[model samples]
Target: MSDLYLSMGRKEGAAGSLYWAIQFTNTATTACALRGYPGVSALDTSHHQIGPAATHSGSSYGTVTLAPAHSASAIARTTNGPVGGPCLRTGSYLRIYPPGSRSAALVPAPWKTCSGIFQVGPVNVDGTF
Candidate 1:
């Protein structure tokens, strides 16, 4: 398997929800293929998993071929809430596992949720900027 690097993208606020792009870059010299939804979870500063695991939103899944230095991305959406809410859970990092891969990469992402649920979209072949 090719080595890939995961990075957190900018957060975009829309309506009463928030969306963030998750970038995946091919760091290895060879190409790699990625498909479906990635496994994502919030992690505390201590590296412990927090809240419920993220869920995939879209039904259709497709494979993306990643060439060296090329990238693919996914979007994660969560409900926006006040500073203090009944569903609040804070995490400083995100553990990401690419589709069908066992290894995980840690990406820095400061997150607060009113609901423990996170809906992740599918990976785009073009990366959709």
Candidate 2:
């Protein structure tokens, strides 16, 4: 997935939920298509997986196509309450995999996450916030 670049947008919050917009840009010269939910999870400073993988929270998913220099996005949410029990850990990074992709990208994120109950939406075409 070197042809694609992954980036996170500003965080938005309402009620008791925190939301993040994950953007995937096609940096190559050609267009590409992405479908389903992107794999997402917290990571320890050592790069090991932490907590349960983010669960799919949205309804049905649809294919997201991107043209060169264009982008697609997905939304991820986390609760304000502490996660996990006494073993609750702070994550130093976030590991992400685009829809139908095996390769992944590591994003720096300082967050305390529980070992359960992570949530993420399905990938959507460009301009989706």
Candidate 3:
């Protein structure tokens, strides 16, 4: 995990769905590989989980090999619930666990979500859905 850097990248919205690019950069001297969906969940200001963790989406699970300074990305999608609904809440951050790793990295991203139930896709080198 120390050899990787995690950050939120581009974002787009359509209708009631919000999508963000979760970027993973190889910061070490050699190459690394990432596979499958990363674990994602929303967090409050106190670093506590705000709601349920993100669910896995899509089926293109393939290994992405990253050279030093290279990057791979996954798409995270969340839908908005009705206003004043119990599932609607604002989160201050996103906790991301790289695939097959126990360590996590938090990225500051304040946004409204439906019970923090994000749908995350597999890591890809193209950084698109």
Candidate 4:
């Protein structure tokens, strides 16, 4: 449950693909979850949401569900490459959540809650979570 890095926040063009990586340490015993999703936009504060691309942190050229004690993992390169102007280049973030299989009070959202949460990245703007 320590030394973790959930690499996310990659952007692409419309219907395009993206890439990123995730790494960790001292967590081979407990399975930790790294939630990759869009953060509050630096340009548009009123629109904290998904957008121009499709699968924002997904399963197939999208998000990643990292296993605990996994140490490190590098995401594949993206298909969309880059998009918009650098300002609209898109920004992503990562949240570290753990398994909620035996917990309560947590909603257990896939890539949001962090508990019983799943990895999602090479993020997109469509907000698939």
What number of clashing residue pairs does each candidate have, in the order they appear? Answer: 0, 0, 0, 12
Q: Please give the RMSD of candidate 1 to the true structure.
A: 2.5
Sorted on TM-score, best first, the list reads 3, 1, 2, 4
Q: Which candidate is the best by lDDT?
A: 3
C-alpha RMSD between model 3 and the true structure: 2.2
Tens digits of per-residue lDDT for model 1, 11-98:
8987777888899899998888888888888899999988877898865867899899998898877778752345556889888888
Worst 10 contiguous positions by lDDT, candidate 2: 79-88
How does candidate 1 fare on TM-score?
A: 0.88
Question: How high is the lDDT of residue 15 in model 3?
Answer: 78
lDDT of 4 by residue, 8-111 (tens): 33333335443333333334555544334322111123333323222233444333444564543433223443243222333233333322222211111112
TM-score of each: 0.88, 0.87, 0.89, 0.28
What's the CA error at residue 45 for candidate 1, in Å? Answer: 0.7
Per-residue lDDT for 121 in model 1? 81
Task: Let me know the TM-score candidate 4 reaches against the reference structure.
Answer: 0.28
Model 3, position 22, has a per-residue lDDT of 91
The candidate with the higher TM-score, 1 or 3, is 3
* Alpha-carbon local distance difference test for all models: 0.80, 0.78, 0.84, 0.32
